[model samples]
Target: MKTMFKKHGPPPTAVEDATFRIRFAELSAGYAGHPVLHQLSAGIAAFTSTALVGPNGSGKSTLLGVLAGVIQPTAGKLHHAGGRPPAFVPQRGAVGDALPLTVRQTVEMGCWGARGLWRRLTRQDRAAVDSALERLGIADLATRQLGELSGGQRQRALIAQGLAQESDLLLLDEPTTGLDPEARERIAMLLTELVADGVTVVHATHDLDAARSADVCLLLREGRLVGQGHPRQVLTPSTFARIWQPA
Candidate 1:
């Protein structure tokens, strides 16, 4: 079957910008003996949303993992200007739901990095959790078991957890996948608000519509950087075909 999306013209070359939150220089990473991401050099703009797009096995998740500090690059260097750990929200399936944790408990976990595992949450910590829940509009569901909520609700809860971390940078992997249109829109809107508030968001996704909403789009194929620039300008038909079409 043909792909669900159409393509446009070739994207213009990426322009170097002075304001960047993170910079990857010749970054390369892999698992075991095999490499998934090749030498990739790119910069994520500060206080903006950047979408990582490509077909499966394109190394989007790998890149995100590197940025989140969960995976070490086999070669090259990744530098973060903020010098603080970023909040990473993996795909919902990655999070085990059998733990019997409530939404509030889950969201509060975001503070563990700052407060330490054994340290008690202070009044300020509690307030941060409250604000995160309220920000995601999940305050009413605070006491609900995470397993009981719908996919959309659960996603919001996870995002609330990320927000509770209060990190300047947020990394998400397919946060809008397998959701209704309304749910996707809600997530997108929330991301926009976060970016406006000086939070940098980078999400790896296959959704073109979601990619278009980002301030910057980074396209990858076979773990190599294919394109990077404004989505409307970079994600053209020719570019999509090059990335998505079978050779």
Candidate 2:
């Protein structure tokens, strides 16, 4: 079966100056006959942070999975300016506790995108892994088992793996979920740094404060996009009532 996402030549000239990192139209998905996203259409601005906010079952994770190319979308038209796919970082607990992989090994997995899984890491690849570890502030825990780390540490490690992928776009599914406030703030700062480095970041989260910090906010309601614009405008009091409460 063909995936909904398709990499193509450069975006058409008309949208070049429009400043969108990614754009999609009529996207839909399902899992075991259960519909997720509807015919959703939206665009993520270039080099900015975007937050996907909605109540449970709003299809945030599904959309992120579509963008990441891990989950096949039943239908959609999509294009990314980067040409290459975005790096996806799942939540901390996604990695199993039983895996014998160390932190460094997990981070090195990011290089598989650039270097094949069977290929040995070059000097540059090793450098990238080290750089990612340092950037995530987990260089000291390089030898630790993934399950041995705290929730925040594991999350950082996952982000480091994405950083090692070195893609222009990033998709994180609730990266700050279940973390201490300080840890959440730290991860938020790291995301800001990624944007500063010219990386576009998209994250689905329930943290309204984090959503407020994003340059763009995508409000989802029952798998449909309800709003797209500055956070201050899209995440409004009245809008919250409409999406979170009974219709």
Among all windows of 10 consecutive residues in model 2, the one with the lowest summed lDDT is 1-10
* Cα-based lDDT at residue 120, candidate 2: 100
Q: In order, how many clashes per candidate? A: 4, 0
Error of 1 at 156 (Å): 0.4
Tell me each candidate's TM-score.
Answer: 0.92, 0.92
Candidate 1 — which residues are off by over 4 angstroms? 1-18
**Clash pairs detected, candidate 2:** none
Give a tens-digit lDDT track for model 2, residues 1-247. 1233543334345555357787777888879799999988778888999999998889999999988878777776666765456889997667798999899999999999888999999998899899999999999999999989999999999999998887888999999999999999999999999999999999999999899989988999889998889988988889998899975
Clashes of 2: 0
